[model samples]
Target: MDEQNKNLILATVLSFVVLMVWFILFPPPEDTGTPTAPTEVVQTQDGITVPAAEEGEAGAPSLSPTVAQSREQALAKSERVEIETEHLTGSLSLTGGRIDDLSFTQYFETLAPDSPMVTQFMPAGTSDAYYALFGWTPAAGSVPFDQLPGPSTPWSVESGEVLTADTPVTLVWDNGNGLVFRRIISIDENYMFTVEQTVENNTGSEVRLAPYGIIARHGEPTDLKGFYILHEGVVMSTDGELAEIDYDDVVDLPVDANERAAVEKKTVVENGWIGFTDHYWMATLVPSPGQAFTAVTKYTQATDTYQTDVRLPVVAVGPGETTSSSTMLFSGPKEWETIRDYQNDLGIEKFVDSIDWGWFFFLTKPIYMALHYLYILFGNMGFAIIGLTFAIKALLFPLAYKSYVSMSRMKKLQPEMEKIKETAGDDRMKMQQEVMALYKREKVNPAAGCLPILLQIPIFFSLYKVIFVTLELRHQPFIGWVHDLSAPDPSSILNLFGLLPWDAPGPGSILAIFSIGVWPVLMGVSMWLQMRLNPAPTDKTQAMIFNWMPWVFMFMLGQFASGLVIYWVANNCITFTQQYLIMRSQGVKPDILGNIRGKTQADSK
Candidate 1:
């Protein structure tokens, strides 16, 4: 086949692979786990669960058994200690000392001015309950259940009233049996909260218990994107290895009889953290770096709840000994900078991996860092994406220059190729031999033109995952009608990019296929312009395929994140400029207008 045919095939295969592979993996691989939910709990992971502690040492604030309740009712059941920080605001439930009412004060649900703030950690008993509860999992027969702080143990404010960056709060609960439990909770300027669990053992006997942290969600996230590209379930890091378990897979974990939940447990000899990760937000239990712990992913079938637990080493508290354990909870948007700081400064192992960087993390990480800095520099995520395209093009310039020069030389040899074709008419072997000889004589590689695009394949998917998964672009605006960069362009072609007053079909509707957005249309046009820089292929099939490839890609990506579409358009425009200049330098003026008008090289001559 001719160079045009190669280009045509390369372009087609590249686009399809990107689409399939970057949903991370098409139909994602089936995980190795029990296919069905655990029937009956026969055994539990060691150090995971213990029998009910004796009823919360009688006098401590006690509540009736927990049942489903509205968020307001749940909040009302326990007096809350308000949490205040620069980026976070929530409350600690005094009843359970749970960080159960958190919301990002800076992030909103929509572009509307009155949009509610993005909330996380709704109180337990609420329909969409999510919370981080910390306490001890007693060693079997080590201590009475009531002696340790359990989910419903009411805590009295022992220190600061409101938890803040400047004021950490300490809550205390005594079992009256000789165990006095104190929890000191502190938050930094960002999202991480450090909880120190201290036990004052007064009894003459020794108490053995393991401190544990739990992040439990009543059900799957209501806003679960369920997009194969995004992970909306349990994400954990064990001893430098990262794992993501979908809600379904978590349910399939081997059953633990004592906990009556499907449980998957791994002992992390050193650093590890575990929790649920949404598209933009996450809530995780981060143990101190180098702290060995048992990481558990659990799904309680009885309550339809999903949980990630970090169980610390068991501590032996002798009479008059005060033992303590410290762990952290990260609950908020998965901002690259914030998570990175925790990883680099505070030493939370691979915390930034908390964002789904996908398989192309090698490229995604750097691309995101560049985009993040660009956003900070420009104060606009859309511009940051465009800057990112420029950066990538810059990096690939040497290769792209060679590819364009090769294409330019190929165009110059087009007339000779036509003569060769005429001379060898129907003698396919002779034609192939002559073409190869011509390429060798001219020092031109027929396949060199594909280098830049081939290189673009991974970069394209990497950028897609970065823009689609990062929180930096969420609700960010570029220009008009593109209010949320992480979302598809809201402008619709059915209405002439919103020239019509009516709203276009939403992404959920079938009509969405016809609802190409303004940015995607521009992407198509840019792609067409780039392709036009070279003469159309003589083969009608290849010509038709090349003609439609851009528009086809445009529609396919119309429903994708706007930031990615912007990046593609920028990339195409840059490539067009580079090719136009390089070809002009090589002394072959591309007849772009003629190509756009469907004029082949022969017709142009």
Candidate 2:
């Protein structure tokens, strides 16, 4: 309809298209070393599948691939055995470190019990350790497949290592070179398993290295519920006018294993952060703000093969020195305090996704904290909201008083303004000149009435963000019927069949909705009465604009949080009471109260 609206729609369309493309191309790569259905194993002349053992079978392994080879060539003349690198446990094999699913849980119904990623990442489908959000590569560069034989040595694990909380066992593995990698795993009081890994180069020459991590989501993308996912650790508003797709839809990226060539062709990041997202909830692994990190998706194929490609934060490291990284996994309900506590450690609080108040946070945070304390005392967020609103109104009462007094004094001078309008005829500019001169002589500041309204904008926006994103109010209930202030009212119904989109929530026990309808009507009635008491805007267009604000606001804000509606209703009622008291041109009068009572009755009808 307008240039702004058109641009907004275009921007939204472009964003969704990009997000769609990214989603398809960036399938998570998780390699679960288990072979999907072994097509064929090394076979003997007897037609038996050799080399590959059956499930649960134990074997004494030998380094030579041809253990039972024909006794030809006298078994290489029985040469003296020598060790290249002493075999030991190393970094857990990442043959299939791919994320299969992602989830977040707030309820205790799941085993993780209010943790976001309980079922998704636990019970690893392929390996013991999961490396996520990091990318992998051949140590020096791309290794020539022709130059190296696959699996001359297989990564190994020992089950009887006996790892315990008191005495964690060391894991060692040879990296096909003289180098040995070591790591230790231990259980913590919180019932969490923690592992620390270190790479040691026993070889005289420098060894090559590749770094990565693993994460998973258990089900298909859309089937995953309650959990919200963030792309590259960024979440945007997905509702209202802000709804959009982050991946470009016109072009899809190759996520299937067959598209492996596409990955090699594209430049991948070396390090960054990636994780599952829950709305007011957060599951993130953030590096220091200035430090760079890569966005990686580990995709596992049906064959149980997985690989990781960096999407961002690309870097490289050189020999000998250890490059250490930390991954702090959170599987709990989204609590702002808890999230904030870890902001410094992992920057996880950034995932809490609070609306940035910018410079206004200095003023608003204190006010919000005080309101939160009151909520704690009352045990009702709705009451706390009401109390905070009134307190703000009371603090600004003097300013509001000045505004109403100026308006009232202007009402007495309306006849003069009207005379100016009449004499000036249709020359609108000349009429304003006369009105300003009259106001200047009367010692009235025409703009003084606007300061209160200006001050409320930031306050209004800050409260709106806090209400929408604050975990404190996620499932909090109010009196009568409203529960889960963070979610839309379940009782509200929409009849899309009508197509005009005017379907409203039917009258229910919700004080919020009821108060909303009643408050607007009250505000309108108060405005009409105040119009009769105070001078109207000098310009007819300006007066019409002011006159229309309440109705427009009522329609737009009808379904808003009951808490916000209550504040407006209270503020209006208070303003009306104050206006009526001060309008009599003297001390308290019976007529003023009688007029207000009549207006209230008329409005109720």
Candidate 3:
């Protein structure tokens, strides 16, 4: 094979190998678990039944019996502290003082305007019950279990009538043992809620207890997207190190003899946050920064629940003194700006890492930032994406210029290379040596053509990650028939470009490969035109492979995010223009149209 063909094949093989390895390491998670009805048991005064545990156990506080009820039934069972904000509406259950019921006021379950609001959290007694509960665990022999407010403990609204961004609510629970436990819940204009718990030790003795926050999900979300690129389970950052624990991994954890879920704890010496992240939304506990705490993630097999906890260090309150602990709960959409604000303004270490930027975070972050700024400037994400493409091409113009110049030089030297091959027929080493000598004498780099492709791999992956995982891209519109850039192109050519009544094949289906969309087809044409900038390879195998590559890529990337497809199509056009101009600058006029006509005639022959 010729040097150009060998390099092209090597590049193609390497690209395939990289993709295979990436998929192998992070394949889309399979929906593996079947939902089983939780066994019902007697209800306790606290509303839900709690299994007994040994005193002073430093683990998940206690397991609550499963209660299956509708979301309305569960909400009606408890007197709630209404939560109202410009962007959120939910109620805090007074039963456990849990921030349970929440819904985004702006987002909907579907694109239809009448679709129900996106619900984020629900209290116990509901299927897939998810809620956040905060309280203190008393030290053994220091305070009785009953003395501390349990999950069922009734809390009276002591301060505010309604909880709004400006108004805070305080729930008071008096143990009647000279200890008063007060919780002050305050919210912002966004989704963050600050919960401050104070215990007044009027018992005439010192008492020790640890403040703990728990976010529990009864079962894996039934609506989990399960895509490999997006994280949909436990995500935590401890002392700047982040971990994403999938639900399946949590379920596979080793259990105790009692069948309790195994607990995995990481000590955060400085600052951290722990919680659950959905595809677009998240609920996390942000403890006070600059303090040591224990972060725990566990799955309870008995209750079929997944939980994340932030257990602060034990504190002792002296007689007639009050000790207070504060934590922030973030329960809302994973908007980049909001999360970044929390990370910077609130000093939450690595809080923005919860967005699942994948392995190319360094590239993805800056790309998203530039895209974000451009969106702000252009007032359209589609334009922002196009602007991003222009910016990227400009930044890489120098390298592209060199690469195309070298390619033009190589094309000019093709005759000399062929002559060397002929004279050194069947002598591979001599052919290679002569080719090297020719390349050096002509000041051309045979490998320069590969630079642009090599650089594009990471850039492509990063853009894909940004479009796949960021909330800003969700439901974003570009142009006609492209209402959601984060999703695959909806218009398919198979049904006469939606002229027919039949629907396109769904994603992940075998037939989906053939359901190429308009953008993908355009991308394929652009790529093919770029390939035709040079004459077809003399070797039949090489020519055939090159001919098929553009179509293969077209189908392979048809199901990708529309934003990424747009980027690819744009890149191909820019590359074609760049190579054409650079080749002309080198005085080598590329006969693109002639090349196409010659290839057609040759094939016809």
Each candidate's TM vs. the true structure?
Answer: 0.89, 0.55, 0.90
Question: How much does candidate 2 score in TM-score?
Answer: 0.55
**Tens-digit lDDT track of model 2 for 426-528:** 9866777777788889887756666786787677766765665455776677665466555434333233223436554444533334323443454455544
| Per-residue C-alpha lDDT of model 1 across residues 1-605, encoded as one tens digit per residue | 45556666867876784764355323455333322221111112111233222232112221232446776777887889999888888798987688899999999998888999999889866767788888886776787565678777878998998899999999999988888999999999888899999999899998887888888776677677777778889999999899999888887889876566788888899898999998889999999888998888888665566778887887788999999999998888988877888899988888888889888888998988898788889988888888888988999999999998888887787778778878999886788789889989999987787778888989998998888788888888889878889888888999887688898997567687779898999999999889987655655666777788788788778888898999999999999999988888887777776643344342222
Q: Record all residue pairs in model 1 with backbone atoms less than 3 Å apart, i.e. clashing.
A: 41-257, 53-145, 53-146, 54-145, 54-146
Clashes of each: 5, 56, 1
Worst 10 residues of 2 by lDDT: 41-50
Residue 587 shift from truth in candidate 3, angstroms = 2.0
- List the global CA lDDT of all models: 0.79, 0.41, 0.80
Compared with the true structure, the alpha-carbon lDDT of candidate 3 equals 0.80
Give a tens-digit lDDT track for model 3, residues 251-356: 8777644325566878899899999999999999998899788888877665666778888888889999999999999999999999899889989989988998
The reply for model 1, stretches above 4 Å from the true place, is 1-67, 422-430, 595-605
